[model samples]
Target: MHRLLAGFVSANLFFSAATAKAADLSLDAAPMFNWTGLYVGVQGGYQWSKDRSTEFFTPTGAATGFSQDFQPDGGFGGVHVGYNYQFDWLVLGIEGDADFGRASDGFTCCGGIFTFDARKNWEASIRGRIGVTPTDRLLLYVTGGAAFTDLKYSWNSIEPLFPGVNANVFKTGWTVGGGGEVAVTDRVTARLEYRYSDFGTTRFEWIDGSYEQHPRFHTARTGVSLKF
Candidate 1:
């Protein structure tokens, strides 16, 4: 009876030790989440722009002593597509997006004798992204690249009986921004971002005088993407 009791105790100890070791290994060898794939998404938000400064010149390239400032704000919607490759906690990617909306400003100058207006029709960008994953499901990133947009400007003077004149032009420059993304599921992610774009100075020529405008703006948006 003593021998039987000793054998039973020894077997129980051996099984318990083996089970504890297995559990430790299971905890230590868990897999990590990876962010590597192609994705497509849609986004929408509001944008506000500042002209920085404006210059009016005659057809002969001489200054026209007419100066004013304008600010335009509105809502926009867009779509984006991109691909990302991951290295442990770091992620690198490339993305492109296009947005369309109405952002315009109208006001009168010269004692209400002259009416001037500006409108932003659409904008797009191709950017590179660098991000870090602080946790398995959260990512923080910054992006920058080339940007393009269309702006239309109109003006008329009632005192001089001048007809309305419009100049539609495209501007190109650079944009930079940052945002955070959350992995809602294995194949879907949601993100919120903000960007500032500067389209330098563009010359819009009219019959009598030309206008030089510096287009710059701030944008805030949210989007959901599906990974493949």
Candidate 2:
């Protein structure tokens, strides 16, 4: 009877020690994540845009058609700011940025020729980022959000060989895009992203009984980022 009692006590102690070791091991294997800081960075790349046109009748009995195409491909650069939150292998954040650049095209209708110059004075966005850590030294992520832009439109045309007519217009619209980022160091990260923005459409009326028309645009960019 004493031998059986000793055997039962030994089994119970073995299980108790095994349970305690498993709990300790679980705590050690868990992941630790944190992201509570402010970061700023700059990016630059190229953009492509599509323009559309429309026509209508005025108060007077006259017919007119105005169309313009803007194909501006150039370099753009800007700064960004936001806060980040980390969860194990996942990272979420919101960011805002602004850039200044120019993309231009031309317009023609009703026996007159006009050039449309679309300048991007500033633009911004708020996006969410999701990423994964394949190892301690590398991270890959995808981000997207709402965007906005400020655009200006201008035109020059001939008026019956008497004089030239010039008109300028301004408008604003919303934009959206997605991209990926890679952490190159503790304080620096690189990004390759594509964005699409639409500034809606606007109308330009001139004193020479004529007007110009335009539509929204889409832009894509890529560059690097520095975090601190």
The candidate maximizing lDDT is 1
lDDT (10s digit) by residue, model 1, range 102-177: 8898778768987888889799999999999999789899999999988888877786557778888888899999
Query: Per-prediction RMSD in angstroms?
Result: 3.2, 7.4
What TM-score would candidate 2 get against the native?
0.67
Reference-based TM-score of each model: 0.84, 0.67
lDDT by residue (tens digit), candidate 2, 1-228: 999999999999999999999999999886532343567888877766776544445567265554445565556788788777676666677788877666555555556554445455556676766666665434566666666665555555554554443444444555555666666666676777777766566655544454434445555666666666
Question: Worst 10-residue stretch by lDDT in candidate 1?
Answer: 52-61
Give lDDT per model, in order: 0.88, 0.62
| Candidate 1 regions with alpha-carbon error over 4 angstroms | 1-31
Candidate 2 local Cα displacement, residue 8, angstroms: 43
Which pairs clash in the backbone of model 2? 147-175
